[model samples]
Target: MQFIEFKKEHFIHDEKTGNYSLEIPKDEIGFGDVRLQKKQDDGSLAKIDAEIIDDLKQIKIILESPQDIRVNF
Candidate 1:
């Protein structure tokens, strides 16, 4: 199966803050905050902390997972 990947231009990283920012236009994802969850070892999802910037235009995520992530993204 194939999955949709985020556009290259949408991914941004702030070197100073060690934060990964994803640029989502209001038209694509709406003008609201997006909830992100990380899959746990037990096959459950846990809410991960993230920061929203410029409304829905940007979302900052710090991936600190000790193991490899298997996100559906």
Candidate 2:
């Protein structure tokens, strides 16, 4: 239950679209407790959906939501 800043090396941002791609540790998604949240203008967090692809060692989160803002996991 850690809040990761979007500026870290764990993510990729798409400037053309309001979306992001992130890579995380395999253990982080254990039991499917992973949840995606986007930062709102009011400095609050908003829930967003993502496409998580579990590769062998890491999990790839392909965010489908069009939100070009800070996010936490």
The TM-score leader among the candidates is: 2
> What lDDT does each candidate get?
0.46, 0.61
lDDT of 2 by residue, 1-73 (tens): 6454453344577788766687777665453445567677787877656776776777677774445334334
Q: What is the lDDT for 15 in model 2?
A: 80
Model 1: per-residue lDDT, tens digit, 1-73? 2122343344466778665555545555454445555456696667655554555354334443222122232
lDDT for predicted candidate 2 compared with the true structure: 0.61
Clashing pairs in 1: none
The C-alpha local distance difference test score for the whole of candidate 1 amounts to 0.46
Lowest-scoring 10 consecutive residues by lDDT in candidate 2? 64-73
- Model 2 spans > 4 angstroms off: 7-20, 27-32, 65-73
Q: In angstroms, how far off is 13's CA in candidate 2? A: 6.3
User: What ranges in model 1 sit over 4 Å off?
Assistant: 1-11, 41-43, 56-73
